[model samples]
Target: MSGAKLVQGNEACVRGALAAGCNFYAGYPITPSSEIAEIMVRRLPDAGGVFIQMEDEIASLATVIGASLAGSKAMTATSGPGFSLMQEHIGFATMAEVPCVIVDVMRGGPSTGLPTSPSQGDIMQARWGTHGDHPAIVLAPSSVGEVFDLTVKAFNLAERFRTPVILIYDEIIGHTRESVVLPDRVDIVDRSRPNGNPSTYQPKAPAANGVPPMVAFGDGYRFHVTGLTHNEHGFPTTDPGDTEALITRIHDKVYDHQDEISAVEEFMLDDAEVAIFAYGIVGRSAREAVLRARRAGMKVGLIRPLTLWPFPYAQVADVAAGIDTLLVAEMNLGQLIGEVERAVAGTTEVIGHLRADGEPITPADLIAALPDPAGART
Candidate 1:
């Protein structure tokens, strides 16, 4: 349990959540993501936390929202299908500004496509699964240690912004084991509480940070929470200005802090003419490919995103500014590659190596897809 113990990525997530002060977990079991819930059930009670296996993913997220409103840090885990079922509540959590975490261990999808195989097919879904326009904070970890690190960060971001945060990784990463040295503790952020008198409290009033200070249900502040467009007083509103303000504020809360929220690993990008843009499990393969390319006297690098939403356009743009060609590799046919293309904006040639056959894109696959280094400089 100490000093570089071997840990599965899914197991590390539970450990990280506990360290981040997660005291409640409610989830239905599903492949790839089931380990997180299974571990939480056994470990939570011992940590003085509560764990509940809801009837399904929808109820699972609903229970987590209820627990979060009660002021406990809450979380849930699911795979592609379960995640699909949670979309409605995901939107509700966004509209209500509920602070919580949802972990999605992705598998080949489009309706139960591959239950036990690895796939990054949920990349776009994680960003836009919920209906309507809403801010999304999604973290994708490529390794066991990063799974732990980002899980803790996910909770912190959720509390800080008072919005749902998602931790997404492919099945391979979830099932893979690696030696990771988890820290004894990590910095924790709790949702800001009401400062003024409870008599005049307005739950949805935006602070300077664009996020309203949250008052838990048991904290004596009576406020409303609804999916309908609401006023600062948290009551239903149809006024044009109120609706616009409500929607815009929720977005600004995250976008205004995107620099803090966005994270990427740029490996050997300097002086490199070619770069690979990848995330999740493919990030590891891309990293190895970069090393192999370098050994072949090719100037190849990698841009592995840790925080996927807000899309890291600025980071990708900077990399594209210098590189001659940016190759995107993912387990899906094409999802994030379009985003990468937008980020590059013709600054560099963009190409993709995509697959959705429930198998990973290996280092050799990426290396083969990469442009000829000898001609890349021309």
Candidate 2:
């Protein structure tokens, strides 16, 4: 937590995984996200862990799930198209309740999109990328330093809830050079270990918080885990009651304790009639807007959500209560802004400074959207 060095966003992600006790990474090299694999190759081995380059995105995701089942803190990283390729496996991890981290460094795309460029186009995909009605715990890190912090939190959330956690970042955040202060590994949280005899342990036994103690496959507990909804004994269940209970618990455990999961940063929002809301690199531009708006005597503010999923609805809603015009700005064409609308209802007019080109959202882009915003900053 001392000296800071300039590092790429992908490498910072690797450090985050390492600090979070992630020991297994199985991924195919994809632009933007490829640096995650690259850094893991050089770092995991030195930490007495394993790294693998699977043949394809599907295999990469599948192998990571397998590693998680085998009792390792596992993860895989990919960009937009690769994220598309891993959908079924992501579904597999979700249904199976496997704890692993999937870092999607977003690039422009419908197919391959923009490989080396930044885009927030995958916002919806991350929400419902996998097939079915499972819940997602997605984290978006706006800065290189934040990418490291949130990666550790992503693993903790995944392991705690027994689900696949997605760390969504844009190409801008993944490749940007910034100074990040590394944390001591001891300060990070590791997954809870089951505290019982291997032969007698039960992976499906419900705990007070709905999270069953996790034991790696070879290390101890012998239990069945499948994508199929299962009984408390871990065997697939045909009972409608059984399926309902499993799915509900998966969603509740996270939703119930949202205060622990939701993270955001506020900038000069107090007493402002208008505010700009955003995250990732877009937030930086919004920050600049706040500064300029304040200098020009305009009552404007900014709200940046560090965690995208488990959506910061409550926080955004609370802040919206005091504002008149709430502007939502992002690199995507009004994706997150809709969430702002949902939170604010029709009480606040939410303006959008939307973008879809393979370029970073700039301060000029946002300030240009508002006519005389700086003049009203007083």
Candidate 3:
């Protein structure tokens, strides 16, 4: 396992979490994502970490939050239905500013719709399911190697921002095995700890970086943690100014760091007139489709986003400005395409190659969605 081992995407995630200093895992096993929990149960203890099999996804994230507050880098893995169950806690984590990671290996779902199938139906849910005006950091990796990389990045983002970060991929990517030479070490970011007098500590007071320094509950720092609108002291408050400041600060912490948090991979886009905007497993298909379109003398390219939240609007707008058309391919029916259209802002024609029948979008499907070569160029 030291060099270029063939690893499933879910396994890579567990390895990356461990590499990122994740010392706690709490989750209920579900299809596609179960391997992550299964591997953690065996690997975490060996790495001097703790693993708990919770009764359900809700409790899974709750345990992760507690562990994180107790100074452990914690995470949980689940699929669509389980993800739905965890939304309330996700919001609580966001409001409480708890640092944790949640891996959602997506399956087809409105209500346990397809358990063993692949679908990108949760794209919007990852950002909006928790409700209210909240900040979100969600990463989607297309390949096994990238899965490892982004999982590590997810932890770093969570710890740096003091918020929950989600790493999501479809069933295909989760179960697929690929040879990857994972790095022996990766840059890890831990939550900033308070160094001043514990008595004067304000749990919700942010530093210059817009993130509050955290002190573990057992570290002799006494501070209240609640989901209600609280001031810098972390106690519940109903004052208009305090409530507004609290919400705005949380959202600004992420938006202000958009440059560091947003990641997108543009493939052969400089001279291209037509672009494919895809992510997750569909991104792989889009990559192949771009190559095929190039072989056929078409100016095709790809915009594969590694970071799903914060939308990468500027990146998409820059690409859209120069392209004649942008094709959005996803496993769901038009979830993120609207975002693309909004970014495009009518600068170029936007079209969707969508599927939600528990099937993966293939290269041919993306290729077919492209305009003919003769009409593609502006």
Candidate 2 off by > 4 Å: 196-200, 371-378
For candidate 1, write residues 7-41 as lDDT tens digits: 99999999999999999999999998999988999
lDDT of 2 at 263: 87
Q: Which ten residues in a row have the lowest lDDT in candidate 2?
A: 369-378
Name the runs in model 1 displaced over 4 angstroms.
373-378
Give the root-mean-square deviation of each candidate in angstroms. Answer: 1.8, 1.9, 1.8
TM-score of every candidate relative to the true structure: 0.98, 0.95, 0.98
Where in model 3 is the C-alpha error above 4 Å? 373-378
Winner on TM-score between 2 and 3 is 3
The TM-score that candidate 2 achieves is 0.95
**Any residue pairs clashing in model 1, and if so which?**
none
lDDT measured at residue 343 in model 2 versus the true structure, 0 to 100: 90
The residue-level lDDT of candidate 2 at 36 comes to 87
